[model samples]
Target: MKKNTEKTVNIWDRLRQSDGQSAVPTDQPWPKIWQGAEGLGQDFEPDVEAGLKRLKAKIHAMPVAGARIRRLTPLARWTRTLAAAVVAGLLGWGIYLLVQPATPVATWAEITTQAGEQKAVVLPDGSKIALNSASSLTYRTDMNEAAERQVQLIGEAYFEVERRPAQPFKITTRQAEVEVLGTSFNVRARAEETTTEVEVTQGKVAVHHLIRDEKVVLAAKEAVLVANDQPLVQETSPHLNRQAWRTGRITFRETPLEAALPLLEHYYNVTITWQKSAAPACSITGNWQNDSLTEVLQAIAAYTGITVKQLTADTYQLSGICK
Candidate 1:
């Protein structure tokens, strides 16, 4: 061991003293030292020239000393591309959220009434609505001078809209759309019925059909009926009892019994079936208010000489002939 140590020290000393281009002295006992070192590992073989060539090539490829050359494989390149895309998407989404307009959330105020019930509501803009039985009125809570004042009605209602020429009041129904600057009107848009009726008692109103897209302008005391797939029919003299539900006043000026029966049924929410095959040429005329259904029926029976019988709770039968 001592001899081998001395030989290794001598080899290192000579390597340090020799210039890069100088060759080791052939006279030195180099073979004995190498042979002695090889005995320590019988399978060890040295390829000094090939190892030096590989190290030199690696150092030459580097941009600077001790700096590693990192080559990006296909998978690494794809990962980097995906990361950039994700970052770009995040930035784009952020920009979009910042620049996009905020959508306004609508706040609604609704009033509904059941059968044989009634309700009245005053809007924020001073418009009044009287909802009849089995009716509903829906409007936005934020209706003001700056916003559009629009209301949706189902069934029957009487509207006394305040005059706002700048922002016209609009009423939307199932079959018709009524727009007016200011008006007192009655709208009957019953769900069970396909036809919608709009009567303007005061001011002017523009009625438009939803299905046919036909339009008609109604003055005071004018009315229009909008039916599905039907032309716009404007009435110069609308029914007198159009607002009877709201006012509780019904007037029949020589109205035929056949026509008056339906009006009575509507006003009292009763069903009257005529038993006779042919209706008599009977006419009724009077103004009544705050009268019971029985009193009204009795009056009609006395005037037309028709027999009124209570068949059921809400169903009634009418028989006999006109006096």
Candidate 2:
């Protein structure tokens, strides 16, 4: 054994002195390490494979880089916490995007008609409203909801309310409130007019004053006029002409010229002024369906034995000038 060790030492010394010029056999290097390992095994156990497995286990169980571990500073800890919070927030937002149907935005609708112009709108509940000249209707998009089928009206509108017992429709005007389950009626609450009128052509309606709280229930062919602070007064005249303007017709059954002229002006959105205070007293009785302004004026002149002349685009004058 001593002789073998001397021979190995001399070989290594030669290799070092020659700077690897004298090449050593590749297989000869591990023999020296193996000899050292074999000497260590003799002190432990006879089974090399079992001892090696135990050593590997011990190495794996030892703490890895224990001295390199460092505690976070206050600022660093906060940064870590904020990063976790940001991740959690992103996760929550992603979950929110997965469920629940998106809600559509609620919108308000408004319709305004100028003079000589009219408009018709079908409400969300399938109810119909015909707005007359110089009229406005305001409503919301989500109107079909219970107690939400409400509309605000100004000027004149003919309403054909749909029958919804659960959702009673209500019309609010500046002068009064008209509530109905189902009704076809005409509401005239013009700002210039002295009285607010409600005439039911079909069905029934409950009309109440806004500021006064006085309520009146009117059925088909019934009409009421609500004046400020006064009790509700039923109109003595017939309600047949209540829906005349809707059909582009003016029906006068023994209606006086002074009163009929206003209806004609309202229907055609025109103005008529007389020069004399003592004008010809004549009553008009006819049905002018969808007639032009000039045609209506000529027909009126023929019926009243007066002359009609256009003063302007929207104005007409009456006199005995035409033969």
Candidate 3:
């Protein structure tokens, strides 16, 4: 069973309380932090590039639109936070194994993307995966070279799966199972959501409902929304824009408001609502790249003669296009 959110939050709190304050003075060189990190892990070599990337992630997670920023009060606290967070992750899971004996667990590799972050990963078999914000993909250590490739996914990601004739690649989510020899597809399986979404960009995949004994095959440009414990069904994708997040460009080819709005929602991590009759006769076509939510809304509103209004950081309303 999954742990509760409060429990996870408490862990972060305890980690902060573990008293890992850095003692080095400001005059101390980068080598000191490097040495401290090295002491934490024997095999760790401080990679400047990788460290910068982590710093970038911390900044990126902060909202760009006048969002509040929480600063670590002291320099030592910042260092301690980083150190404790890493150590807690490495030690927390294994600590229980000492008290109770259990079967050996298979080694797994996990890649995670934080909110507002995107990651591109290459598997051992040359398969590629693009993880969207707030998602994780986990696979066995021997996944690529093994007889069968199996993976677990949570949140959203796009896969450019490698073809291994003897080995079948399968992805398991909370709501559905997907199998393919080689295909490019996107999956959205948010933990709190009852519906699992799959969109195929190339080749085909077989999707099997986890709770129900239902199955369907989806071809390129096809998609499906499998509700929790419900039947599996294939349907045409409302738009060919599912993988657009990876490219940072959402393409709309005469896409209707109903279809186009969801893509914008995904890209901006926002909620949008409009009247049922809003822009009923309007179809949109354009490519939006690295644009803010407000900017994109204005462009769409201008094109469709709709009025776009921002209600909150993550909410919007649309009107005036359908009349």
Candidate 4:
């Protein structure tokens, strides 16, 4: 017992003198040291196999000698944790964006006019549209929030667009699109007609053919026709009679009777028939404003020496020969 006590005391003394260095010599017997430590657990029976396994596990867990151990400060550990959290949040956000559905477009507000009926409307943007007979116009209700003010048109209509440089006004038809900034223009895109016409009465406008991808720019009193799959045709001097329905004015310059009759019929919403086998070769040259159909017919009879007779409330007939 005295010999064992002396051996344990010498081991402890050598460990204290070695400071942080490995105190046990390579040639020292490990069993002797283990036997001394077994007394620490006095009530437990120390199994040799279990004790060897535990010691081997501890040896594997220990860091290698002479290796530098860098200890992280509290702030560094917190920064690493925060960086990991941010990366995870960004990954989740990207997945959410990929799975979401697209937003839908806004609905349109529509206005229409029946046969021989004319209607006038003031848009939300303070622009004015005068719809002719058998016409339809549509615009988005949320036009103010949109980047551009856009309207779709069918049949004929006159537009007086309000000036907003940041938001341009656009008119879309079946075959053509017209864009402008503060302008007065007329668009004729009747369903029965194969050609669409755009006439600018004030300011300027750009016309594009939807199918052929042709484009033209027009100033005041200029016009363009977008025919089916054809190149754009621009006119420098558009006729004044194009807006006669709105202005209540009609003018004819050396226009044949056959050609002039259709204009009058459309303007008055009436039908005219010729009693003779063929229409007279006489041409008409006159201007009438706010004139009744009968009054205008009388002037035509005086000018061409033809007999004008009313067949019905909305019908007229020409019988006599041209002078």
The local distance difference test score of each candidate is 0.86, 0.80, 0.81, 0.87
In candidate 1, how many clashes are counted?
0
Query: Candidate 3's residue-wise lDDT over 237-277, tens digit each?
Result: 54456667776777878788898887787777789999967
True-structure lDDT of candidate 2? 0.80
Q: What tens digits encode model 4's per-residue C-alpha lDDT throughout 85-138?
A: 999999999999999897669879999998789999999899999999888999
Candidate number achieving the greatest lDDT relative to the actual structure? 4
Q: Which runs of model 3 end up more than 4 angstroms from their true locations? A: 1-105, 251-262, 271-290, 309-323
In the order shown, the candidates' Cα RMSDs to the true structure are 11.8, 13.2, 41.6, 11.9
lDDT of 1 by residue, 1-323 (tens): 56767777787677767775447665688657676775684577899999999999998886875867699999999999999999999999999999999977878888999988998888999988889998888998877844578889889999999998888888998888999998899999998888899998889999999898889999988999899888988899988888889889889999988888887888788899985554558789888898988888899888877888999899999888778
Positional deviation of residue 19's Cα in model 4 after best superposition, in angstroms: 52
How well is each residue in 17-81 modelled by candidate 2, as lDDT tens digits?
A: 77556655644675577457545524554789998999999998998885596889999999999
lDDT for 24 in candidate 1 is 66
The TM-score ranking, best first, is: 4, 1, 2, 3
TM-score of every prediction relative to native: 0.68, 0.63, 0.57, 0.71
Q: Count the backbone clashes (under 3 Å) in each candidate.
A: 0, 0, 0, 0
